[model samples]
Target: MLDAAQEKTFQNDILDKIQSHGWLLGESNKLNKQLVLYPEDVIAFAKAT
Candidate 1:
């Protein structure tokens, strides 16, 4: 299990990986949830591969 600081580091690592793979990150539009979504192009790319 990760401590608070270690958890932050892990999150950053995952985000970096996502960006490096051409995935997107952004704030959610709905008030009920907060999240980042990987855009459709990333899914298309993966399907093509």
Candidate 2:
């Protein structure tokens, strides 16, 4: 398990990568605790990076 600081850094890195590729990062839903990403967004991200 990640420590608090490690988790924060990991999240920040993911957020930065997503935003850098012009993709939105949705908040995790309470029920599933998963972040939402559209299929096209992922494709675009893949092509961009």
Candidate 3:
């Protein structure tokens, strides 16, 4: 399992990738909110992005 610092860095990395690609939209924000409670979704979203 990732430490808190690593988890935060991972989340920021995902967010940065989304922002850098200009792919974030309303639905993506909703998905990100879901990610806070369901971290596994991050991997799926990252793959999709």
Which candidate's lDDT is highest?
Answer: 2
* Positional deviation of residue 48's Cα in model 2 after best superposition, in angstroms: 24
User: Please, what are the lDDT tens digits per residue for candidate 3 over residues 1-49?
Assistant: 9999999999889988998998553454444463453355566788899
lDDT of 2 by residue, 1-49 (tens): 9999999999999999999999766654422325445556567789999
- Deviation in Å, model 2, residue 5 alpha carbon: 0.2
Better of 1 and 3 by lDDT: 1
For candidate 1, write residues 1-49 as lDDT tens digits. 8999999999999999999999766555522333344455457779999
Query: Best candidate per TM-score, number?
Result: 1
* Candidate 2 TM-score, C-alpha based: 0.46
Error of 1 at 14 (Å): 0.4
lDDT of 3 at 40: 50
Clashing pairs in 2: none
Candidate 1: 10-residue stretch with minimal lDDT:
29-38
| Ranked candidates, highest lDDT first | 2, 1, 3
TM for every model, in the order presented, reads: 0.55, 0.46, 0.46
By lDDT, the better pick of 2 and 3 is 2
Stretches of candidate 3 above 4 Å error? Answer: 24-49
